[model samples]
Target: MRPQENYMVIISPGLLVQLMERTGDGRSVSVRELADAAGCHPSKIDALRNGRREKSTIDEALAIAKRLGVDLLVLWEHTGRTVPVPAEPPHIAAVPA
Candidate 1:
């Protein structure tokens, strides 16, 4: 993968910041450190932290939630975040006469 070309996950910066403040163990962590721990780029973390992103993959979200000691579903719900996945259409098999 090329630099700055990684698939970044979107997330709610406000919610994340809230969670971090509430649960960050009183430890000040940098964006680069968080990104390193989350297996993403610092820009991705910064984007999510600064309200520049809106969506995130399950893995990334889970990692972040774990770091903040918050439940993924709970945080997602609090953030008003919804999955962008389209509902799978029902399959209809053709019947031969």
Candidate 2:
């Protein structure tokens, strides 16, 4: 018998929406602008916000995070429940494995 592979799911649309809302004030940015910044289509961003898209590329997420001025890991933590940054700045470190 073959064993089923265990997959680790990371990030969620709700969390993404939360981060976006937090940074964008629900209108701080438009879908078109987010798409342009993320190098993706507006529909993709819409889908992500609406919970239709579950998987996201690291580059895409990073770009969005950069645009939002939020830490990539902070957003990841919002979805994955994993803290990738420390409480302090300048000496920020990844959560120990």
Candidate 2 local lDDT, 1-97, one digit each (tens) = 6563222223666766666665744446677887899898998789777755544567787778777677776654332335232222333234756
Best by lDDT: 2
- Which residue pairs clash within candidate 1? 10-55, 10-56, 11-55
- Candidate 2 clash pair list: none
Q: What are the lDDT scores of the predictions, listed in order?
A: 0.59, 0.62
What is the C-alpha lDDT profile of model 1 across 6-88, one tens digit per residue? Answer: 12234456767776666657665567766776788887777678765555556676777777776776565322234343222
What is the alpha-carbon lDDT for the whole of candidate 1?
0.59
Residue 32 C-alpha lDDT in model 2? 81
